[model samples]
Target: MAFVYDLCVVGAGMTGAAAAREASIIDNYKVCLVGPAEPKVRKVNTGKEVFGAHYDEARIASSTSSKVPVWGILAERSIRRYSELEHLSGVHFYDSVGSLTVGTRNSEYLNKVEKQANSQGYAHSMDILDSQQLRRKYPFFNFSSEDQGIAEENTAGIINPRKMVMAQISVASKNGCDVIRETVTGIVRQPDGNSRVVTENGRLIMTRKVLLATNVFTEIHNLLGDIRPLYVPMPQTVTLAEISPQDATRLRNMPSLKYRGYGEPSWPSDYLRNNNDQIDFYMLPPVRYPDGKYYIKLGHSDDILKGPLQVSEMQKWYCGEGDKALEEQMFRLLQRLLPGVTFLSHHGDACITMVTPNSQPYVDLVTPTVGVVMGDNGWAAKSSDEIGRIAARMIVQSDWSYDLPKHMFKLYTNVTGPPPASKL
Candidate 1:
């Protein structure tokens, strides 16, 4: 008879890697993480390729999330462990340049951010800047007269998603966890009350329990048998502006920016004009990519593609360059935001994010032997470690042991009607 492992985590992205590490360290349990490595070159002709959003170089990391207060809590917990994980794995990925959130003065959004920051005792690490102060401090940025900023100087900055995932996997490998580099095709139940994870390479992994962190590909593979989670795969595009070395150095002190306001009359496109909640955008500081070039990345919160993508349509979308018109619009917006800045070149790429009905992650069990921790909703990269820890504890202890209400992470499946408007 073949040996049965204690737990098998399918999906080696940020959340899955963190869960594998937590499960291995919680006690003496045989754990394995299964997922394919990033492709050397992105090609859509190959029908066997799988892509993840964590293939990027920079993602904003801050304790203040505009979506909900619970997300902020998750970010704080994970940010507190970045240093420890770095030391343990010997991988440096976090940049502590701080983060900035800008919005209208005394607006509901900024008020909620201020309340959460104060309640979390972050007053000492935070600085509130009025419109004049923002202009005086960051002259390169242009903002309206009603805009105010909250600068988080500590535990808020940018993280390289690739390096972060590598760090977690390194720690887990040293803790006696097995790492399998393959794509999981499906998960099936066994006759002995266990689960079998099927891989694309014809390998079967038997375990007492399985956790699916496959993100956007979760529903496409039908891993949960007959039950399907109600999620929409929303397409997202990001534009990168390549600057010269001198320009990069000049903007070395720039912080990650999250802007919430309607800029100039010509800033928004027609799609943005129809929606009241579509004027939000985020920008990352200049980061060096694999090609050894520094580029500043920017993306909008609203979906410019205009429709929820079906699973079959995802591969073709990723194969092609993102919406060229939207990319041009973003480039123009960047130029206006930083007037007189020279951009050597610009390009865009396509990606997908899973949006749930309520805009929160579903970290619940699908059955007695199969569990799931997915539905990123566009905010999981910053808080993945804590989310993984909670999931690991739930599986290891056979119960939901986290302080957060279990219902907050409950699973929603087989719903009718159209999906709700995204709050990302």
Candidate 2:
């Protein structure tokens, strides 16, 4: 039977949508997106609601906590792609300014920032400030630390992520592709290279190529194996709280930044981003609310709204009520750090983080018809676009531009060093 489309995408979230859009617009291939018919009633994940929380138990068992992520190197690549997106798709990227990485002098914790910056030659306005110098420059930083900070005044800032995703899809649809919403129920590989995607509604889509950009949802398709760094699927609360003009000014002077060393020697870290309307705080977990129910991005309750992160084996801890514990701890952490900042959320939701054993994502051809695109962490932001581009390149050539070691696909785990072809 003839395939109905050249390429079919599963899932309609940011990654899937972007991939579908790219194949159509960049590759000019006919495409269709399969998922829900409409924005169906989304159930919540109680585990994700755990506002700003972390777990000793979870971290103790984590495989990649004590070291700088090997995958962190991929960020420079994404930045390059973002620089090109405006010209490639007519999408303008607004620079959010640079990032401030805080820590004490002689501290190994803050070294990750230095290492990355030196290797990438990223142009940023930066400074190494003493405790007094740091305190005087930014009034909001009340914490005292013996360590110095490496401020990258250059290339760190925010890119309207939602806008980026939407623009890509818009470009794709305009380029002669169809986007569908249907829950894929089955798959049929025909005698030819084409495949048919069956939906819950008994509808089927046939295509010569299929791309799976369904982040943590890949668990549902039995498509992932025991990869490491072990991504945890938890709810992330991004509260866009309104800041007073005076308060906004104070925050603005501080700029967008990240803190690499504060807590554990090898435990997870936290970061912050200051924007026009609000600032965003990001961490692994220990989130909480005054009422005991976990809230993501500041909402009224404990219900976990189902999004991309799932509750399967690789992502099971967040499927149930894990958020309750995370939220409580997260609040305590925030209270210590932000002292007096009111806790109110405007856009909290759970997200899936693909952490591999070695800090790399699973971007390999699992089968001739299917390729997996899971980010351990780097792909969480800009790398996603590059990932889609990589997939399109693979499908079009039936060959990879970058060569992989013979064992890269054979290894059940991810590695950071000693592998040349493994570079992404």
Task: Find the candidate with the highest lDDT and give its number.
Answer: 1
RMSD of each candidate relative to the true structure: 2.5, 9.1
lDDT of 2 by residue, 201-287 (tens): 688788887776665555554433333323445344333233334444345434444443343222224422122211223322122
What is the C-alpha local distance difference test score of each model? Answer: 0.84, 0.48
Counting clashing residue pairs in each candidate, in order, gives: 0, 54
* Candidate 2, superposed: residue stretches over 4 Å from native: 1-3, 26-28, 36-41, 44-70, 83-95, 123-125, 221-246, 263-322, 340-349, 403-424
- TM-score each candidate: 0.94, 0.69
Off by over 4 Å in 1: 264-274, 303-305, 415-424
| Model 1: ten consecutive residues of lowest lDDT | 415-424
